[model samples]
Target: MTTVVGIDPSLTAAGVSTIKHPRIAGNPNKPICATMGRQGSNADTITQTAIRIGDQTRRIWGSLPSSVQLVVIESPGRPNPNAPGRFAERATVYYRIVEQLALRRIPVVTVASKTVKKWATGSGDASKAEMVAAMRELWPAALIRNDNEADALALATMGAMQLGWLEPELPCHISPNVSWPKGVVRV
Candidate 1:
């Protein structure tokens, strides 16, 4: 079975999720979700930030199953003025993840933020609150604690839909309200 992993990269709280579907590969079961980030107020210097990002990336890479065939990550966009160095830090982390996955021969897919938002909430410009609400409504069982998890779920669902692994049970012409089975393993 092939598994798809979706990641929302961040130095503070990077969200990681995995969905396994043998049918997608014409085969059974597969699993995984979690947040990756270093916690420390003393991480002030550039080196410290880099180390933190590396640690987070390593954690995420280590957590992925060997069956992971595809990794979809939220592509980095313009820098956030409230968070200086965020763009560079996230870009480095993203590159590190891609490099590690490349070494393992696992393909990586970078989904645009707008794409995820549109897929999850039917609006490319949906706000964080909208995303959270949409995900909660779609998968009431999962505990979507914050926007990061919601985004991660959206990213995973987008990848699944793109791969034709997650066809919405509901009938729709364009993007439908899709949902995956519950109990996705988390670490």
Candidate 2:
């Protein structure tokens, strides 16, 4: 079984999910084999944020199974001019997490926020509640507690569809523009 991981990286509460599936032309039956996330102390000051990033990065990487085939992470939201500090910290953490995966030679891809929404709810402008509802409607067995988890799960499923690890189960958009890096073997 090939493992696929999905992550919604937030310093406060990152949502992570894993699924193991055979890369064949068929539907995945309740494929949510595992779920885990790293919760860190609040990152307030620059030093605290740096420390949190390091700790969370290591924990996130460790959370993955060794047989992982692909990782799909939800990209950070746009920088809010008012909350510039928070945005910067989040962006930094996001890149550091991605870098850690690259160092380990793992194939990682980041899906845009709207892309995830569109894939899950068939609307780029879908609300967070809408996403949660859609996920509930689609994958009833998944323990999706919040929007973060729902988004991450959607991203993983979309990535699997994109990489040909599973059949497309949703009538939504997986952007044709996503460029998988060199190590990723596209089917």
Candidate 3:
């Protein structure tokens, strides 16, 4: 079985999910779905947050079967100007995840945050609550307790659909209203 892993990285709370492609054609099974994080007050330092994020990621990777072929992660956009310092801290956590996966030689794919949101919900600017609701409607078995988990699963689903391992619930294009040229719908 080939598995695609999705990660929604953050220092406050991160989401991890996986979709396994079975030998036979059928629904892709999401055998992993969870969030990991320690409160900022608990960590108190950026370095501590990075350590916790790395440890959590390692634990999740260790639990997986060795058949994981691709890692799909959200692209951490430019830090908010109003919260640049805080952004750096969270960005560091995201970088740690990418670095660890790269060290393991796992192929990492970055899907934009907006793209993941649109892929999961119908709108690119969907709220966190909307994302949660959409994911629940799509994958009823997934216990998406928070937006992070929903994002992870959504990114994983996008990767699987892109790889042709699973059919997409919506058009694969990031833009829902995109007017593709004739016969150029798939991305």
Candidate 4:
């Protein structure tokens, strides 16, 4: 039973989803539980956000079962063309999470925003509403509210698909030989 935790890191409101292998036969990728965490608005500084995200990640990671084998985080896609440095803030937060995960010796993986979106909704440019709709279709009882949580859940689902954690509707083969260190896997 492998456990995978996915994160959509942000300075203001980091989103997270934890999934476990299904206990019943014929179903392997069902998530047993899920959660989300938001940094307090009082944490006005980027440094404070990083610290908060790190602390929250540590706490959540600690509470998981010893069987947890992988942690997947969503990497910021191409920086906003119009905003220029808009992604710098999120990148810093992602870096901090990666650093902390490495220190803990847990295997970490990263999936691009486009890749996760495409995998979830069949369109890399899918809107937040579309993503949320797709997630609801996948997990009818999932109680996801905001887009951040939906994105986090999508990242987790993509990670599970990549790791062959999910039983696909169509017969498919995922290569386990591909090497992924503590960072992003370019799809």
Candidate 5:
């Protein structure tokens, strides 16, 4: 089976999740949820963002499964004046990941922030804690470590639903909720 990757891209903690084979010889072969990320304070300088972008990109790239066919990433957040460089940092990681995957012809789909929230928790403005809680309720098997992972899990589950490998069972339409690639559809 192919892998569906979900990413909540960020320079600080880039949440990456994959719905692949199974966990620990999963006899029934039911796919499992796996998540990973590195959380740290935002960079303070241009040089810092530059350095961390490479590191974040590497981590994301390493986390991807061998047969990644679809990637669902949350749209980049608007720039925050307080952070100053937040927009550049985020947009860079988003572009690099897409660019890398594009080279291999992997289709990447982006979902709006509010759409991710609403689809996952029935509210477009759900809080980070709320997202985590809702995801845990949906897939308790996953060790949801943070909000980023929760968002990424939601995004991945959405992609999995698109491919029919997994179903979130939520009361939401995948195609209507997210902008699908050319001809992909839920099975």
Candidate 6:
């Protein structure tokens, strides 16, 4: 019963799924247990958000059984060019997660957003609703309230599939390398 936790990190809210890998067929990837963590409003600021996310991560880490083995995090998507300073903030959040997970000595893997989307919906550009619908098909009883949590679960599913805990359920598709249109670094 290896436990793998997938995290969808955000400044205000982070979605976490703790899955107990099962040996069952068809539903081999099902998470025997899961939960989500919400960082309070006061922690929404950039600096505070990083700290809160770290705290939330630590809390989740502490709660896991000794059998737990890996941690998977969805790499924050590249920031919008029109939004100044957003890239830095997003990168900050991502780095914080990686750093914390490393400190815990848990093997961490970062899955790209496009890869996750493609794996879940057959299209990297699929809408949140489309991804949610696909997840429902995979886990009929999964309570997918929002895109954040759904995205987190998708990352978990991908990680589980990669680790061989789950069967190869989705078709194999190669994800194109992420690229920026033009000189858009600080934007």
Q: Which candidate gets the maximum TM-score versus the true structure?
A: 5
70-94 in candidate 1: lDDT tens per residue? 6778888778898757788888888
What are the per-residue Cα lDDT tens digits for candidate 4 across 1-187? 4667778776566667767655532343445334545546543576765566667656555545666567778886668877554476677667767787778687887877776677677777989898888877776666777677788777666566666656534221233223366453433
What lDDT, from 0 to 1, does candidate 4 have? 0.65
Q: In candidate 3, where is summed lDDT lowest over 10 consecutive residues? A: 176-185
> Each model's C-alpha lDDT?
0.72, 0.74, 0.71, 0.65, 0.78, 0.64
lDDT of 1 at 25: 35
Question: What overall lDDT, based on C-alpha atoms, would model 2 receive against the true structure?
Answer: 0.74
Which candidate comes out best when scored by lDDT? 5
In model 4, the runs with Cα more than 4 Å from the true position are: 24-67, 81-86, 170-187
Question: Lowest-lDDT window of 10 residues in candidate 1?
Answer: 178-187
Q: Which lDDT tens digits does candidate 5 get at residues 40-150?
A: 465347676677788988888888887887899988878888866678778898999999988988999999889989988888999999999998887776788888888
- Tell me the number of clashing residue pairs for each predicted model: 0, 0, 0, 0, 0, 0
Ranking of all predicted structures according to lDDT, beginning with the best and ending with the worst: 5, 2, 1, 3, 4, 6
TM-score of each: 0.79, 0.83, 0.79, 0.71, 0.86, 0.72
lDDT value for model 6: 0.64
Q: What TM-score does candidate 2 get on C-alpha atoms?
A: 0.83
Q: How displaced is residue 43 in candidate 5, in Å?
A: 7.6
User: Would you list the clashing residue pairs of candidate 5?
Assistant: none
Could you give candidate 3's per-residue lDDT for residues 89-144 as a string of tens digits?
A: 66766676778777877777777777778778767799999988988887886678
RMSD each, Å: 6.7, 3.3, 4.8, 4.9, 2.9, 7.8
